[model samples]
Every structure is written in C-alpha cells, then in structure tokens.
Target: MDARRQGIVEVAARLLRERGAAAVTIRAVAQEAGMQAPTIYRFFEDKDALLDAVAEHVFATYVAGKAQSAGDLDPVADLRAGWHTHVGFGLANGALFALLSDPARTRPSPAAEAGAAVLRARVHRVAAAGRLRVPEALAVELIRAAGTGVVLTLLDTPPEDRDPALAEEMLEAVLRTILHDAAPVPRDDATALAVAFRAVVPTLPTLTPGERSLLTEWLSR
Candidate 1:
C-alpha cells in the first residue's frame, strides 16, 4: 500500500475509534490526515470505499494478533481460544466490528475472508481428528454466526446489564452441537464422509484437476 493511502486509512481508523461510523466523513479523515478532501478521493473512490479500507486495516491488524497468539494445542482448545479472541476484539473495537458485520456489505472484505479462512482451518483440524460431529463447513458457519451474534448482542446491551457468561454459554452450546464425545468413533454418515473427503481433497490424484475442483466445491457445500 502507498504511504499516503495507508496514512489516510490510519487516520480514518482513529476517527472511527474516537467517533462512531457516522463521523467518519471523507472531509474529516482528510483534515485529520493533513490532506485535502479531494486528495482522499485519489486514493478512495468514496466515503464507503474509505470506510471499507479502514475496516480492512483494523480487522487485519486484529487477526494478525489473533494468529500470533494461537498455539498448536488441542484443536478444540485452539478453537475455543479463537472464539474468545474474536469476541474480545469485537467488544474492544465496536465500530470496526460493526462495519465488518454490516449486512449491507454483501461481498466480504479481504480481511474478513482471511479471518474466515483461519476459522475454517481450525474446524478442519477438528474434522481431521474425527471430533467434528457436523460438516466442517457447517461447523465454521455455526461458530461464526454464534460468535458474531453474541458480540452484537452484547454491544447492544447496557454494559451493566450485559450477561457476563452469555458469550461463553453460546460458545459451549455450539460446541456441544458440533463436537463428538470420546475419541472419534468410526462413523459412516454422509456429513462425516464429506468432511473427511474435504480434508484430503488437495491430495486426491485419482481425479483430474477440474474434477477435483468440482468435487471440492461440492464437498464444501
């Protein structure tokens, strides 16, 4: 990224933290960055673009910290750690979190995709260990949805009225729904087969490249 563009994003992110999304005007960011409003246009198409860039910058930084903190412990424990980190981040950075969670965004930003990829890898580990009771994709979706929902709910509540255990309860509920008891017993279910196939899809040489791609897509569903 260009220095000027990065500078603008940094200023915009700070503004977002200081004031809410409604205050992140292009003119305000440009003024904070010691540049003209028109200069901001050279780097960003519009205020929405600029806000998206700010969201990307902030989220990427948070996810980087999350990656650094993650360790190769038990896969399930690692996933729990990820869940805690995600909720904590959302609570601390409410504006950036809300921007990333906006339903109107439609297409996800690169940072959002990177975060999802991290979760997918963690879920895949659970599946590979034969501990996932649900399809890997489904488990990822459930966890993502639950975590986001919990954060949003907490953000909406008065701090004093918030349930301290809400986040943990939601996480444990999802875990019970998606994880197996004991060591993964041999299961012949379709979901299990799909998850196991997805784990090794990259190494399947029996199928042609196009076939493998198609199969992988199908299994992901």
Candidate 2:
C-alpha cells in the first residue's frame, strides 16, 4: 500500500496489459518502477504472487474510484451510477479488465464478492422501494447478466467507430429486451423514468469510458 509498492503493482499491470502476463517478470516490473528487482521480491514472493497483487490492485483501484462518483440518491440511481462506472472503466482499461475478468484471478480475490455485495444491496433496495418488481436475488442475477451482454456487444466494436447512433441502437435493444411488457404499471417517484431506468441500468455495465464520464458529469451537475 505504500507508494513504491503501489507503483510497482501499477507498472506491472501496464506491462501485463501491454505485453502478456508471461512477459511481466520481476526484472521488468522493477525496471518500470525504477526500482531494483530485489525491492520487488521483498514485497512479492514470486511472479505468481506479484501477478495476484497486480490483479487485486487493479480491481481495488477501479472499485474505489467508482465508489467516489456514486451519489447517495435512491437505489435506482445508485445502481445506474455504478454501472456507468463499471462499463467506462472496463473500456478504458480493457487490458486490465480482461486480466481481472479471468476466472483464475477472481477465484482467489475478494473483489468479485465486493462487487456482488454491492449489486445485491442495490437490487434489494430497489425491490423494497417498489421500483423493481422482481425478486431481489433474481433481479441481481438478471441485471448482471444482461448488463454484461450489453457491454460485451458494445466493446466488440472498435472504440473509434463507436458513435452515438450505435450507442442508441444498443440501448434500444437493451430496453426492448428488459422492458418487454407494454402495459402501464403505477409509476415510481422519478416518474416513468424511475421505472424504465431501474429496469435497464442494473442489467448493463458502463459500455464505454465516455458513458462513465457522462455519469460522473451527471453526478456533478
């Protein structure tokens, strides 16, 4: 957690992302951190240990940064704010994103559980508030899976080619899939949007860094 240790982890992640994990040796990480290889060995036992640390550091940084921008509104807004951060962070840090997403890395880390807890709480709150009609646990799973699908689809396209129209197309597809019923139910506090947004936001991750930025901007405004 010290500056030098943190720096080493970050430099290692950059290397792991730029090169593959195999390419990130102690010597390489130390070189990037401008420290001697022995210094790294003091903090990390071996390549595997360092790799684990790097993975943890990346997820922690991401989650911490995201928690900052999440405004303390209702559960629906909280869910949307978090999704936007997740998608944006994933897009901008795709290499780190892919690495952390590997099941091997996640199995040993608490990061995944932390995210799950946040999702569970969000879903539970929305359901309790009557903003979401689905069961809390089921809602969390459904929203997470749906959101992952949306993000993966958007990320499959090149970022440079991602325009607003393309984004709108994706959003519309997502809306249709989740909000399949047309009949009106009693609206929630934020009007129809409270219902619509809650139904949609938790099911998707932030698809791009731009979307994440938009959420932060919205929070600020």
Candidate 3:
C-alpha cells in the first residue's frame, strides 16, 4: 500500500479505537492523518469503505502473524493452537476483542472475510483429517463463535466466581457443545483446552464505542 493509503487506514483505526465507529468520519480521519478528505477518497470509497479497511487491517495483521507461526500437522493441535491464540489475543486486547464482537461490526469487511476464509480452510482441513462429520461453514462459525463467547463470558464473570476450576468447566462446556458427538474424543484434550479453562479469564468491563476507540489509539501506539 502507498504511504498515504496506509496513513488513512492507521488514522481511521486510531479514531475508531478512540472515538468509536460513529466518530470515524472521512474528514476526521483525513485531519488526523494530516491529509485532505479527497486524499482519503483516493484510497477509500467512503466512510464505510474506510471502516472496512481498518477492520481488515487489524484482522489481517492477526491472521498473517498466526499463519507464519502455525504448523500444519496434527489437526487437533492446530485447532487448539488456533483457539488458544484467538482467546489469548482477545483477552489481552480487550478493546479490540470487544470491537470485534460488536453486533454492529459483526458483518466482516472484505478483508476480514478473507481472513475468515483462512480460518475456514483450517477448519476444513481438521474435519477432513479427522473424518469429522462437521460442515465446513458450521465448524468455522462455531469455532469463531465459541472462542468469542468464551472471551465474553470470561470478561463478564465476577471476580469471586473466577475460580480456576469454574473457568475450566465453562471452557469445557463450550467445546462439548460443538464436539459433542466426536467418537473416541480424548478426555485429556478436553481438560487441557484453553478456551474451556476459567482460571485466567479476562473479565473485561462493559465496553462502549469510546472505550474501543481508545483501544484503537492504544494499539496504534
């Protein structure tokens, strides 16, 4: 990408993180990026277009980084690793995670959809290798949803209820819902699952668009 285009995306991302999506106007982004609104138009079709680009920018960074680090062997291990990364990243980046789970932003941008395609491919690979009866789309959706749910739940739990055992139980329950029919499923795998465990859950506060926007600024920095 050109410097100007990248600048627009970065500025938009920061604004979204600091001001919520509602505050991320093209003119505002242009001003933040030290460019004219027309200059932003050179890279984006409109404000919606720019929002999508920002979403893609964040999501692609994650997907690319994971791809570089992931090993293709052991479908189950790959699945676990992917889940671990998802949950870990979400918890660690509470603001970004909340932004991602926002119902308003749920419709992924083209870039985010492309990243999701990569996730779908991995799901298919695991299902094929295991000869699991899961539909590719359903598996992909379930995996993503389950991971998000786990993070959200953790973020919602009371401090007193954050016992390690409780966290483990919650994560296991989530996986059981999806892998309920898997024959010869290993109990150890279920027990060792990261998303299923409760001890280190995130427990983020209720977030607003402003908080998420702040996260964007923090992330950009």
Candidate 4:
C-alpha cells in the first residue's frame, strides 16, 4: 500500500481503539488523517471497507509479532506460546478483538483468516508429532473456540475480579480433549494411537484411495 492509504488505515485504527467501532466514520478518519472525505473514499469504498482495512492492519501487526516470537523447539510448547499470545492480544485490543470475534460477521477478514492459518499450521505440527489425539481441523477449531471464549469471558469480568489462571485453565481443558496424555494405560494408548493414525491417513501414500477411504470410515466409527 502507498503511504497515503497506509496513513488512512493507521488513523482509522487509532480512532477505532480510542472511540470504538461507531467512531471510525470516514469523515472522522479524514479529519484525523488530515485528508478530505473524498480522498478517503478514493482509497476505501465505504465505512465497512475502511473498517476491514483497519482490522487487516491491526491483525497483521499482531500476527507479525507472533510469527517472530513463535519458535519450533517443541510443537506443544509452541502451541502453548501461541495460545498465550492470542489471549494477550485480545485482552489488549478489546475493540478490534470484538470486531474479529463477532459471529454476526460471517465473512472473516484477511487478518482473521491469516491468524487461523497460523493456528492450523501449529496443529499440523502437533499431528505430525503424533501427539494430537483428534483430527487436525478439529483440534484447531477447539483451540480457537477456547481462546476466543476465554478472552471474551475475561473481557466481561472486572479486572480486579478476573482470575489470572483462567486462560491457562481453559487451554489445559481443551488440550486434554485434543492431545494424547503422556504415559497412558494400554487401553487408552490404543485409542490414542488410533486417533493419531486417523489424523495422518490422508498423507499415507502406500494405501490405495479406496483402502484409505475404508480405513478412514472404520476408524471414525
């Protein structure tokens, strides 16, 4: 993006943070950006377009920091790091986070999708390590739901009353559901192994398509 467009987005984002969604009008952004409303229109078609741009800008900034801080020494550790970062970001940017979390907004912005993609990759790593006890997509969804729900719950509570361990506890609860526990008993180990194999079935090249499909159906049953 050009400097002028970037400037517009930055100004709008500031207004959004300071005054919430209703404050981010084109005229208001134009005044903040020191540009005319028509000039703002030249860059964005309407208020929703401008808000989407602001979301993308804010989300990209947050995710860029996450990408830098995320390391691969251990996939499970990396996943936990990501969960903490997500919860922190949402708490820090409540307005923008609300925009992204609203289910009424059926179509996710690019930044939201980018964040989901990062989570998907992390879950894939866990699956490849044979630590995941559910399908990769299901694990991703569970984590996403848990993180978002935890953030929203905290946001609704008074800061003085908020439990510091709520985020960690929620993450652990979801992890128990999606991950294989260490040193399981024989019967539990069998179930975990089956789940892990089902997760990797799509990548097995040795099996014919029909055989793969049959195995998948049986495993699902």
lDDT of 2 by residue, 1-221 (tens): 78888888889988977887777899988888888999999998888788778767777877666555444766666766676676676667666555556666525546656666777766555644555544345556766666555566666778776653543354444434433233343554244334434444444575576775565345223
RMSD of candidate 1 to true structure, Å: 2.5
TM-score of 2: 0.63
lDDT by residue for model 4 (117-141), tens: 8888788777767788777778999
Per residue, candidate 3 scores C-alpha lDDT tens digits across 181-220 of 4544345553323222221122335656677556534432
User: CA lDDT of 140 in candidate 4?
Assistant: 93
| Clashing residue pairs, backbone N/CA/C < 3 A, model 4 | none
Model 1 earns a TM-score of 0.87
Evaluate all candidate structures by whole-model CA lDDT and list the values in order: 0.86, 0.63, 0.62, 0.85
Deviation (Å) of 130 in candidate 2? 1.7
Find the 10 residues in a row with the least total lDDT in model 1. 181-190
Model 1, span 108-210: residue lDDT tens:
7778888998888888878877778778778999999999999999999989999999999999999999887645635666676677667778887788999
Candidate of highest lDDT: 1
- In candidate 1, the residue pairs with backbone N, CA or C atoms under 3 Å apart (3 or more residues apart, or in different chains) clash, namely none
Q: Model 1 scores what on Cα lDDT?
A: 0.86
lDDT ranking from best candidate downward: 1, 4, 2, 3
Candidate 3 vs candidate 4: which has greater TM-score? 4
Best by TM-score: 1
Q: lDDT of model 3 at residue 99?
A: 62
lDDT of 1 at 61: 73
